[model samples]
Target: MAGITRRKRRSTTRPAAAPVTPVADLIRRDFTAPAPGLRMVGDITCLPTFEGWLYLATVIDLHTREIVGHAMAEHMRTDLVCDAIDLAAARGFINDDAVFHSDRGVQYTSGQFRAALAEQKIRASVGRVGSCYDNAVAEAFFATLKTEIGATIWRTRSQARQDVFTYLHYYNHTRLHSTIGHNTPAETRTNHYHQASAA
Candidate 1:
């Protein structure tokens, strides 16, 4: 198959070397949420750019499949994940009891990220190593993003960032999802709120 080719980063990822707080897998792979803000999954992916690699972290709402928060940077340090979560909080999409699910990546397991979650009053849920099913929704979103964005290496980091920004806007506003009755994520969330108010 003449499929799109993405630039592959190194396969091996290091576990957090220092002792870090281990959060329970509260989600247990159940991605379906009763409401928009109650559950979220986050992950990081690398995009190849001519200058270097651009790392993107995202927080996605389970109910609407909406990317409520995102952050992009050259490094995949723990701050990248923290920035994404902070954006979700700033956008008012995260609730105190929200279960923020993620894989056991070093960034998610770092002491800094755990502290960030604590400060936000969001519950942290981490899946075991080598368990894609635990964070399937986030993985699915990255797959869709890579598919739509295609495989060609971007000319520059700025170019990659701009393209991602455009794509995310289209994804959140225009793309219809079968999961939420063929509604765009924004539409699904809006309709949910409207329905809740009516009730």
Candidate 2:
């Protein structure tokens, strides 16, 4: 008979570090009712695909609940968020004292991402770790996206990109939000501006 050897399994225990309290403070400081272009919420979410999961980073204006900017990337790097921020800035979303709020994900805390905000005079607010309630608005938008778009496994990144873009256009200009009184984001913003002018 041949000799058999056995190997010992190693424990997967890890050290527990002190809780990060700054994240909670940041969330509390940033959470507020929406004012046009003054506050924005952002987050990244994953979508399944046959090739791999697609990551989407989105920035939405809390006033109209409009997804003002977004980016899709194969990697959830800082650049993914930077791209969204750049898009929002290009669309004139960045004004003095604007605040960009997101979870304490490393991507959001990266130097490059922070630098961009600093350059635009925008403040960065990070939500507490493991607390999704801090970013509930962004999460709710993602849920609405998944529900209305109908999840599908993408065969390629390009396909996912196209589908996401199409859905975003519809989301901004067509899909009605109950919170905004069943008005699309675009419509809500327009109506707001018109009412302000009339008043």
lDDT per model, in order? 0.87, 0.75
Q: Candidate 1: which stretches are off by over 4 Å?
A: 1-5, 9-13
Single out the weakest 10-residue window by summed lDDT for candidate 1. Answer: 1-10
For candidate 2, lDDT tens digit of each residue in 80-131?
Answer: 8899988998998656778889876777766778788888788888767677
CA error at residue 19 for candidate 2, angstroms:
13
The lDDT, on a scale of 0 to 1, for candidate 2 is: 0.75
Q: What lDDT score is found at residue 93 in candidate 1?
A: 93
lDDT of 1 by residue, 1-199 (tens): 1123556654323456545555789999888999899999999988887787889999999999999999999999999999999999999998897889998888898889989999999998988888889899999998898788665588788888988898898899999999889999999999999999999
